[model samples]
Target chain A: MTILASLLKRDLGRFLPGTSSGGTMLPLLFFLAVAMLYPFAVGPNPTLLAATGGGVIWVAALLAAILPLDRLLASDVHEGFFDQWALRGISEEVVVAVRLLAHWLSFGPFIMLAALPASALVGIDGETLRIVELGLLAGTPGLAAIGIIIAAITVGLRSGGAALSGLLVIPLAVPLLIFGAGALSTGGDGGLALTAAISLLLVAIAPFAGGAAIRAAREG
Target chain B: MEPFRLAARDIACRRGDRLLFARLSLALEAGQALQVSGANGIGKSSLIRILAGLARPFDGTVERAGTIGLLDERPALDNDQPLGKALSFWTALDREAAPLEQLGIASLLDVPVRYLSTGQRKRAALARLIGQQADIWLLDEPLNGLDVDAVKLCEELVAQHCAGGGIAVIASHQRFDLPGMSTLSLAEYAL
Candidate 1:
């Protein structure tokens, strides 16, 4: 529908790379920074690096997902965008759903692209790199979902919300982390499927949860 | 442009543990305007929001028969974007061009919204509201940051809107002059 398209276009503009509030490659850069620092901290131990690099990438991706949470829904809610939408007979669910897709598009693919060089920096092998990429592909949607749900919940908080959202995402993201990073160790497609399944579930539920959170925030 | 109506009955608003007001009621038919006036924290904005259906009344129901437009403290414009681009977003959604020149924001369209003065931002919000062209307008403190000329322009716009058979409910402590505009002092219903 045209409504959804317009909403997506606006969201992409606000959140896409290189925009002022959009995080503009900060998450990707942060992921690379984490990857680039691991080798130095571990003193160039190839075996140790290879063994832990995939997990490190997963952790970094999780953190990177949180980087944009503060901007995800807070600014719109604060500026009364949600209220305006509500008045127009547009449901919060639709807005949050569009936002979830936009949030994923803004960071998910870029993080996946950055993982190649990140693998090189962290000394992950070709086999591990393939699994890491695939696992991330399966997991990032869930990460984006977690970020949005938490962002909605924390949008009404004045102080410490960014930090609080980050903290809240960690525990909720553990399932994705376990399944995604587990794929690296197991070297099997089964873990990837499970990660994808979890991602699907999270994606399915994010819109409703986020929608309720936004409404509750308005009430508060 | 469709026939519009807004009605609230026995509406009560509670914020946190405190009751702001109780047993408030009003009705607006087409071509009618109401100004909600009260001191700060007297639920003027809350009353406007309750009528707009953005917030739930603690103990009543609101019935509305047309599309609603709300203007509040926030302009709902992207602060980082140029004013033209920001208004374009709403214009695209509303499928109508904003009256930028009429709102006196045509010259400042290239400026980032963050760099705009409060009055400029308010005018931009007015443009957005105009573009929406909703049948019912819920304006909360719409005169807060406008200059003398802008305030008069705002009154004229509202008057024109009401003359066109649209309904407007304005909530502000500042006196808003309009012919045949009914005023509601919220203090009467304060608990």
Candidate 2:
């Protein structure tokens, strides 16, 4: 239990926004940039903006999640953190699990919080904003899981891994995107429940898959 | 601290399509030190990793009864963090304070790890290893990047560790002087 706490504390320090890792502000700024630019690109049509804004936010959130994926597990593996942890009898699964939580905490809630201002920029109504917020809350854990799994797979790549990881996440994230963004259109709790279920499934499997990837990377 | 043992039998290591070494075997009881010496690409570091259980052998078995501590090329410190904060992360996990003064990194605690010289970074890694206090030490090229004084200090530290009934396995082409240290040449086992 103490080990988990220390791991969480260290991961939070490395991953938290505004710290030396530069984690906090970049994704929020990027999400807002996407929101702020959509109106300019499409011209000022209130109905059009409101109708498409929720989808745009979903896309923006997915892209923002990608921004931190490259840094997620690559740095620690390169710096020998995983090797040290293995020597201490700490499983890679545990480390990756803690990292998944830290990765989500670093950006998931913040992105949800940023949605209010973003909704204003994109002209989403209060009702739509509520759905968007809930969808994101249920969906971001899946995003974080996708991010960590891809990060582990790509950590051993020599070059272009950051770009590759971003590419890999999009296809895997489509289910989350469909269910999450579909909630806004359908106005049903079923979509939200499915989104949450997908998030739960991804969250459950990420640590084991990611742990195996890291251990495999050690061989190479 | 308790009675410790590490032994490898009929080990074969293959990297990619190439076999680095084959049919290598060795054993160490408590208070013993072994130095693995060979030229570059001779599988010295590979041997150390195999013993540390971080890498799987192409064929064979490794048996051990003790915790393993490893020091390698990477210091494992967060480059952006101050030295003190970086080491403290491990200290907190290990539940032991690092011997910063003994490692001569006390004055360097405030510096970002990236700004430190190679030798300073090596010393910081040593402090982390000391804090771990494991029964077996697997050090890969521990003498690299150290000044003359630091090298001597490292040798002394290893000697002290062995004297305290801990085991040391060092893999380096560079000479590492320690009393009662046996040397293994990987060239003889190269396939």
Candidate 3:
């Protein structure tokens, strides 16, 4: 627990005003702006909007959420933060756990917010919006977990771009997108149920995937 | 706190296509320091990684004791990170000097480390060692950028760490003088 606390603290501690982007708040606002622009850009077609709203919102959330991941571990892995975590003699599994959670908190919320305004473009109604939002809230952590594992693998490489992450990450995340949209399409209760099952599955998969990813990245 | 004793036999590391060092055998005991002297391209840092447990060598077993503190020439700081928060990466360190007090870098602690001068960043890395409470010190050109006083402070710290049964292994091109430190020139052992 001490190690977990310390690792968690260290992972989240990067957010201390001085450590990372002091202007991080701006990104959230940027997402909001982007989402709002979608409705106008796509033309307000209600039927077209509702059918696709769920998928568009999820993709946009993922796109925005994934933007910073490569950079996230890029800095720390090179800085020996990952190495120190390795040498701390703590379980690397726990470090991965802490890091994924922190990344979700930092990057995932903005994705949700980014998708919120864009939801209108797809013709999502009020209740659907709530379901999608709630579904997103529950499901985005899985995206972060998957994204982080992918990022950790690529961070040490000289060329760790979105292209590279796509190669390894797509297969693992299909369920997240599928069930994520399922929850919103079917209703909150349905989405909630799927999110629960998927979240549990993610917990099982995260440790192994994250562990391998960290090791592979560091070896590079 | 014998600077963690290192027990290694037949250790060899291959950095890439080339073998950095092979069939290497050495035992570093408490209160001892060994300088891993070699040319720049010979995998000095790679050896440090193996010792620090960050990398596993192609062959050989190594047993290291105590917390190992590594100070590479680069300091491994995130330029975007401030001095104080960046310091957290050195989890092995426990604080001994306030960021501002030791290197006159207190004001810059909040500044992105990338924006700082190379010398300033180096100081922050060294200061992190003071915080780590590490008994096994692996310094890869720790003297890169520092005034005479800071070098002396480092020497004193290493000496103290050794005096407390700690150990230090350093790799450097510059001349570093210390009493009773054993020297193993990688040149002499090169294949």
Using Cα atoms, each model's DockQ against the true complex is 0.75, 0.83, 0.40
Over A79-112, each residue of candidate 3 has an lDDT whose tens digit, in order, gives 6666765655655677677777777777666666
The alpha-carbon lDDT assigned to residue A145 of candidate 3 equals 74
Q: What lDDT would each prediction earn against the true structure?
A: 0.93, 0.94, 0.71
Q: What TM-score does each of the candidates earn?
A: 0.98, 0.98, 0.86
User: What CA root-mean-square deviation does each model show from the true structure?
Assistant: 1.2, 1.0, 3.3
Better of 1 and 2 by TM-score: 2
Residue B47, model 1, lDDT: 90
Which candidate leads in lDDT?
2
Q: Candidate 2 residues A26-119, lDDT tens each?
A: 8999999999999999989999999999999999999999998888999889999999999998999999999999999999999999999999
Any runs in candidate 1 off by more than 4 Å, and if so which? Answer: A20-22
Q: What are the per-residue Cα lDDT tens digits for candidate 1 across A53-141?
A: 99999999998999989989988999999998888778999999999999999999999999999999999899999999999999999
Model 1 Cα lDDT, one tens digit per residue, B1-191: 45689999999999889999999989999999999999999999889888988789999889999999999999999998899999998888899998888888899988999999999999999999999999999999999999999999999999999999999999999989999999999999999
> What's the candidate order when arranged by decreasing DockQ?
2, 1, 3
What are the runs in model 3 whose C-alpha is more than 4 Å off?
A1-10, A13-34, A110-116, A120-122, A166-171, A184-192, B1-3, B76-78, B88-111
